[model samples]
Target: MSSSSTSPGRDSKARAADAKPPMREALVAAAFQLFLERGYEQTTVDDIVALAGVGRRSFFRYFPSKEDVVFPDHERCLADMTAFLAAGTGDEEPVGRVCDAARLVLGLYAENPAFSVQRYRLTKKVPGLRAYELSVVWRYERALAEYLRARFASRRDGNLRADVIAAAVVAAHNNALRSWLRSDGQGDATAAMDHALGLVQSAFGTAPPPPADERPEDVVVVVSRRGAPLWRVVQEIESTLTRD
Candidate 1:
């Protein structure tokens, strides 16, 4: 026995290895506190990792950069949104399905109102964070557009409709989110989001498909001399058609 296997250092290392999830969360919590206490530009990754009691490598292992820690749940929320869109049946309107997907995003923010509000304020102050937020927003919009395009592929204006609806849904979602965040997360977010989503639904959603047995009414077409009187043409056509 080398004795190292039974050493306290070895036991501590094993415990730390098993606690990766909590450690990652610690890093995130520490980063947010630091960003709040000392402005985002003032806080460094070293400060976060030190407060977290973790190494620089651990920070990188969880978040790619300082900005990522601010929106830590984005990856999980994006995946949830994608899953929601993927599970939709094609029978429903594309716009409605995409709107539902947008709800997943709002749900994520709603789950942590304080964190969301804080991040919102910080993002508005930081150009780099805002740009990163835009990239995330673009990814969400692209996912929605792809789903809509697939659903409407057979239609003539499918691509255009898909693109437009996706943009509209994103716009509506962001509007609701910003409103809630601006108010310090104090309003009925669901209601605000519902009102925003309703606009997109009314504008882009298609009515239910007609019954299978439904048929169009027969058209009465009359071809007569261009100068013929209207009463004469109508009477002559009706009499001729009804004769059979």
Candidate 2:
């Protein structure tokens, strides 16, 4: 055979290799498969690397630990949320902006409903994963709170209001998200999220328009000390904000 005749076969082989999954994706696929086949505890990093045909160093390069692999997209999602909050136009209410940030999270899960449901189930069964997930959730909550604090800094109760609204948004979003996950990712998740956010708006949002037959009370927001823990401030603000 001539050299030109062999060129096509070599090019096809090169293209086939180029089209193969990336190392990170291969590791994720191998890890999940092993975790499902053998219980999470039964699987090890070695097994994952072996299945992926990659070395242990390669696995570590992609994921810090086995638990990290379970929730691979968290860092990306958190960055996206932070960016969205940072890009706020200053025209929207703080609560509304926070609600919009929470929607980013919902959109992330909705993009991969099947994987979200499976990962939710796996996390429940693994204590380490549950703890990791909690820490990730707190990161998201903190991002929103930081943005709100800057928005409300001039107000008397700025810090307190920021923490409270942040917690409330996270709580409402989780409640709606968990309900959808529990149902195996069925139904309209966006609709459920809207309803949950509306409740939050009613409780902590700007005062709604009063009926023509009634008078409107002047709304007042009380500020708390800046040195206190976020959770304490959140509790105090929540109790005060939810009052009829």
Candidate 3:
């Protein structure tokens, strides 16, 4: 909802006026600051509004509810993640890319560690916030699943297999990230994420086979070198061919 109703024909200045950091970021920063100062429950939306230098109306325009402030750019993060997945999260080094995306989310917290820590504490104490956060995590997992489904569309299991793989990836990422955040972002978090994902590959029990229909049954021997040393191997093959 905009405070001004100048109408569409009001000219470009009106639009420019409406264009006001995004109000969302401002509210998040304001709320985060208040949470640090007065504590989570002690701080009110009014406090956030006052701190943001915006009216109550503007605050509501940006966030549907007060709890939304804790998430900040969660929607934007999902969009970025979707873009990453679409760009081939299925590289030869898929696990690497998945871990990189995990780092991106972690870095969002690192961008404002103090606020992240505060929010973390609040979320632990607040059931509602905790639930909301978990849902956000699931959104990421679901996106990964859809991406994998698209990447391996030709597989028999297709989306089902993708769902399982995505679940494993998401779990690994969250576990590693939470451990790192608890330790104040210490250690090789990326490596830890990779280690977790490695389990997925091992659990699958086989290397990824060639794409369906790309291989034919039975065998054809092009060249054999069971014994004969070095150059002798080629000589043996030539001799066999000549004798035939």
Judging by TM-score against the true structure, name the best candidate. 1
- Per-residue error (Å), model 3, residue 116: 2.3
Over all chains combined, what TM-score does candidate 1 have?
0.78
Error of 1 at 234 (Å): 14
RMSD vs true structure, all candidates:
8.7, 13.7, 8.3
Candidate 1 Cα lDDT to native: 0.87
lDDT of all the models against the reference? 0.87, 0.85, 0.71
What digit string (tens of lDDT, one per residue) describes model 3 on residues 142-235?
8877866776689899878778877887787778767766776667666776677677766642454677898666443446557757687777
Per-model tally of clashing residue pairs = 0, 1, 0
| Regions of candidate 1 where Cα sits further than 4 Å from its true position | 1-20, 209-244
Cα deviation of 93, candidate 3, in Å:
5.8
Candidates' TM-scores? 0.78, 0.75, 0.67
**Lowest summed lDDT over 10 consecutive residues: which window, candidate 2?**
12-21
Ranking by TM-score: 1, 2, 3
Candidate 1 per-residue lDDT, tens place, 1-244, comes to: 1133655676653455345479878997899899989999999999999999989998887788999998887877787788788776667767778888999999999998998999999999999999999999999999999999999899999999899999999999999999999999998999999999999999988756677778565567778999999999989888977975
User: After superposing candidate 3, which stretches have Cα over 4 Å from the reference?
Assistant: 1-26, 37-42, 89-99, 201-244
Report clash pairs, candidate 1: none
